[model samples]
Target: MPSAYVARVVLREPVVGARTWAGFATMCTGMFIAILDIQIVATSLPTIQSALGIPPDQMSWVQTAYLTPEVLLIPLTGLLTRLITMRWLFVASVSVFTVASCGCAASGSFATLIAWRVLQGASGGTLIPAVFSAVFLLFPDERQGIATTIAGVLAVLAPTTGPVVGGWITETLSWHWLFLINVVPGTLSALGGVWLLTRDQPSGLLRELDLAALSLLAVSLACLEVGLKEAPELGWVTPITLSCLGTSMLTAVLFVRRTLAARHPVVQLTMLADRRFAVGSALSFACGVGLFGSVYLIPVFLGFVRGHSPLEIGKIMLVTGLTQLATAPLAVALERRLDATVLALLGFGLFATGSALSATQSVATDYDGMFWPQIVRGLSIMLCLLAPTRLALGHLPPEQIPDASGLFNLMRNLGGAIGLALVDTVIYGRVSGHATDLAARLASGDGEAARAVGIPQALFAAHAGEPADPATRAFVAPLIERAALAAAIDEAWILIATLTLVVILALPLVRRRAEPTLEKTP
Candidate 1:
């Protein structure tokens, strides 16, 4: 082929070559922060809540505000790409994200904090799907194996390192540093993208903005997310909760009808018709539940149940991050030669095994008890990110890849949201029941129960104004609460384990992704 013709082809699509590494890094920086921001704040929630004087009931909105907008924007990324060149969209988003981080750090009130979080999430959500789209567009098959591995590392590494870094920042310094921390890295990613990459991202022909669909999507997802977050504390029967649910459902129905009927739909829902795409999406959702669910569980169990400090919790969870990097090279190696089905099954098996080991934990479980399970999860998580990506995307026509990637990533986020809700329900529901059962036995002067809680049966005064105040039935209440929480945490672990293993049933629906053309254009 003539050199000029080759140049044109390269211009049309991102050609895999030397500069690909630099561009990938720039994009990864944006992706890492977007994803990492979720967990970094996890360890510092209490500090943030108290610092801003947030009421206990409203504290959850700090996380929910960010996550809700993030999830809402994910499915719309492909549509955005169609409107603007991807490079410009990404750069603009990183800039918006950077500005929002600063606003969050400067916030002095609960409402102010939530306003910034919504902006931050809106931009951060687009980066993940953009990176996934870049993987196929920028590289060929052999290189894609290596590129995907790198992406997997960033994806898994973000949340894994978040707790550790966030813990250190909170314990050693102040909670405000959590948001201030993003400034340097975020700026560089946005600027670096402008400098290193050739700006050739293309857009679709139709340019009309679908305001109705956009409004419906935002209202539906945001209302639903807020409702879910508040339900645990507010009680599902509360009028506020019910209203949020009702409004969300009405908006969601409108959004769906608008999407299917529109000439240029904001979302291309037709992709779900592909069997491979559908099955792959389910795998993505399940992995999201496992990945996000487990991440949520370990920290809460260690912090609330065991009463560990943020730094100590970080140290315990750091094992998962360290082990994820350790296994990346090997996972990439296996990904190269093995079928997606085989790799997915293996990853799912390891993750399930790890979750099961964790389910056996009692109130006494600690760093040592959790070490093996963390290791297994870290090793398996990379394969979870890699194989499903290929299964969902490797065979799609390149033009359709962007839209498909958006939908694929959206499922994972949805899974995380739903998984957390279900796990919360299970824990809250079980705690009261477990406490009741244990209290009944204690009330009867069960010697075993007395010994288990370190309270002497004789310490009870039997009447008000007890003599052994410190050792009275009041002391026993703490034990029952801890015991009940431990039991709830254990049950949550079992739920996640079962969810992870159930992926095996969907294995038959998948076919190994076809290797794409790796050769430079003729």
Candidate 2:
């Protein structure tokens, strides 16, 4: 028989009062630092690499090590919380994450740093879903919107400000400060969690947890993360990529089947059967494509095509972050009056428009070109986050919220991983072909092509009616590569935009009613 353990897991009534709010805030703080670490390391990787004497080929693993384990651990957090209870789980996660951050800062070599990063990733992964889960568990429906806004703002804000913060820290102090900065926040969050959170004993559900299903879940996600990371460079059909992805799919199937049959599943998979949660998860995935992909794309364009430094890129990228901050109030107000599906459609529609606008970019595009697109996208962020979040978790019972939150958040991360891989594939596969085509046009004395490639029409004019000398070709080669890169990046923007637009179709399936759909386990 299926166990009644799910019903038994709600250890107390929904959290209430000022102390609970403080506890929620502390959880948010821990989550913020954890998310910030990903973006900060991305922005400061070059500096970190030089400091540690890491080879160019190996530097990327610094990030992959962090990301792979984080992905594997996120969904598992639902079960982990049952084993320890939320209060101790939050405290322990924060403490371990802080210690790992310190170890990262103190590391003297590449291997040492990666080891610390793996630990950091494992501990930090739980913080995000834990905060989102708290919003529903700690607040009434009337107040969940405002609370979601607070958590959503911080969630998105961390990534938006990470580049600027990381760049400033590395330039003024040192790359070590990137990790060190997490210490103060982590310490306070850990202490606050212990003091403010309601104490509850674990349900002692470990005996009921399915170890085989747990292993399958971990292996599936780990393999999936690895496959996505390698697919862009190695080609999706290559043996290693195929093996990893195939194994991920196979294990995922077995895991889902095993969990569905288990008396007490490790992580709740039945939540996805609810229409609201299911549709909301899909929308969340789409938002991830836009949110994380744009963050990744903008920095690459600014650094490589525009020849900007990390600080300059960060400053330029501030438009999106600032606009998001300015729009949060309006989004919260609107969430109260509108149906969630309506709000979600509006949010995703505007996001799609913004992404489409960005797809028209040229090599010379800068903050001026990006400003309006950033504003449109910024306007959509909170709308995209708040509504889908409420739709996904709002109707679930307090006990189910934790597991559902983990699954919902997992969809977004998976979307980000896949979106980034596709973006990389587009850039790498197209740049060479685009460069070749532009070179051909230049050779044919096309002034329009000359202008598009950032070469002076006069340069082409000087070589008019004659084969250009090797010197001229060499000079123009770099310009052709730059223009090619810009074109490739634009295509990537369109790909994400299309993805965002496509998910909007599923909104109708979300049902107009907001009542809880699951049979309460008893």
Instruction: Indicate the worst ten consecutive residues by lDDT in candidate 2.
Output: 1-10
Q: List the residue pairs that clash in candidate 1.
A: none
Model 2 agreement with the true structure over 451-518: per-residue lDDT tens digits: 88997777678876687778877898899999999999999999998999999999988878833345
Candidate 2, position 133, lDDT: 85
Model 2 residue-pair collision total: 0
RMSD of each: 4.1, 3.7
Q: What are the runs in model 2 whose C-alpha is more than 4 Å off?
A: 1-15, 514-522
| CA lDDT of each prediction against the hidden true structure | 0.83, 0.89
Top candidate, metric lDDT: 2
- On a 0 to 100 scale, what is the lDDT of residue 317 in model 2? 86
- Compose the digit string of candidate 1's lDDT tens values, residues 1-522: 466545545534555666777987898889999888988886788899889898987787788889998989999888888777678878988999999999999999989999999999999999999888888877776777788888878887788778889988987898888998899999999998887655765666655668889899889988988888777667778999899989999999999989889988888888888878887788899999998899889888898778898778878888998898888899989998788888889998899999999988777788999999999988899888887888888767666777898999999988888888878988888999888877776776566655554455565324323333455557678888887887888898899889988987898987554534445664
